[model samples]
Target chain A: MKNMTMGLAALALLAVSGVAQGADDDHRLDDAWKAAVEDNEGVLSPAQVSGLNILAYESAVARLCDGIKLDEKKFAASVAAVVTGGSALSEEEQVQRLTAVMFQLGTANGLFLAEGAMKKDTFCAHAAEEKADKDNPHNWQ
Target chain B: MKFSRTGLACMLSFGLLALPPLHSPSHAGKTADAIAAGLVGAAIVAAASRHHKHHKRMYYDSYEPYPDNGYDTYWNNVYSPAAGITCYRAQVACYKANGHFSAKWTRMQFADGE
Candidate 1:
């Protein structure tokens, strides 16, 4: 009976400690995000907002994949609050900008992969043509 | 026929060598090779320009997600939930006139890795 009582007490202590650790981690993430926003003068450009949004989404996906719990709303809310500061863009407009930039960057990366994949000769030829084009003064502007 | 053409070109060049040069190659005229290269370059430039125009048109056409009817349902259903917090909060701030949206719980799908 004494041993049983001691085990229960130990389990209860562990549970409490686990909860405390989780709370601390959450607080740390919150503070880190807040600091990141403040460093940007609380005004996030479309690209910056898109970057943070992508990071949050990727982190959430990773957590989901790992079967770990995530308070996605907390992270999302922090990012949104930062991006919204000192911005005249409507919420929809802001979201559209973020999405558009993400799509554009993704498309560029996809094009690079498609153009350069598995064929060094083709890639080199294209790179040379691009370089020759870059040599033109008018092309620079 | 290929050998005859080559022979004729060689004889022609040798015959032209008897005359005084009227102009340097740079000032005279474009060679067949240069002309062919120019045509290929022009075709490539045209194709690339057309492709870029098409891409630009496609992007501009789809840039705006919401019409005059608004994106309330889309905001509530598709985007807010899919994008989760940052977008959800921005949606709230930007569309205060559109009324409130409920916070959505994150849905995890392990089977298909969605």
Candidate 2:
């Protein structure tokens, strides 16, 4: 009877510890999600808002390999590379770097959409180039 | 034969001189060889005087993911993102891997209400 009682007490202690750890994780997830939005404010287009929100949720996953951790090196490199790939040009080097970052965020969001877990809203911004050309005939000349 | 009319007088004299002596045919062949060498030298000099030239066009990487039109080439000139806190913050951390935050995170946040 005494041994069973001891086991029950230990089980209770472990359950409490598990709950505490889960709460800590929830806090981190919230922090990471806020960080993602904070990092990506004006950059995400209206179409990508949905994807970012989804990734924002993934930030909550406690495991490293599973979701996009706002604080991991691999994620950072991937972000930098995507940004480098999507980077825009600017007269100011600093401004140019920011442009590159926009590309990174946009491209990253696009990738997450491709994963099949997230559905993207069709944004008209994709047609900006077409509209610009349609409106300006002299552009081709 | 209109030797004079054809202006072969000087050429005929040279030919006669070029002929091997009736006594030594070998000497006649030597003179013909010298005349042939002189003509070849003149041809070589003419060819060396002429020249050939060429020009190459310029090419560059396309900035567009997939270009729909000709203007795609020019897009690379302006490839950059909007200057934001995230970029500034990320770059700071890039310089120093761990939390060496030079650029404040709040400074670059998107102005759009999230």
Query: RMSD of each candidate?
Result: 25.9, 32.8
Chain A TM-scores, all candidates?
Answer: 0.30, 0.23
Model 1 stretches with alpha carbons more than 4 Å out: A1-88, A134-141, B1-114
Determine which window of 10 residues in candidate 1 chain B has minimal summed lDDT.
B93-102
Which lDDT tens digits does candidate 2 get at residues A56-88? Answer: 222222122222223343333323322222123
What is the DockQ for all candidates, taken in turn?
0.01, 0.01
Q: What TM-score goes with each of the models?
A: 0.20, 0.19
Best by TM-score: 1
Collision pairs in model 1: A76-B86
Cα-based lDDT at residue A5, candidate 2:
100
Query: What does candidate 2's lDDT look like per residue over B25-114, in tens digits?
Result: 564354344333333422222222222111000001311121224222221121113321112211111001121111122112321221
Give lDDT tens digits, candidate 1, residues B1-114: 011323322322223112112245652333323333222433333244344532122122223233323333323321222322222221111101112111111111110112
Calculate each model's fnat, 2 decimals.
0.00, 0.00
| lDDT tens digits, residue span A74-112, model 1 | 433433433333234443333333333233223323323
The chain B TM-scores of all candidates, as shown, are 0.18, 0.20
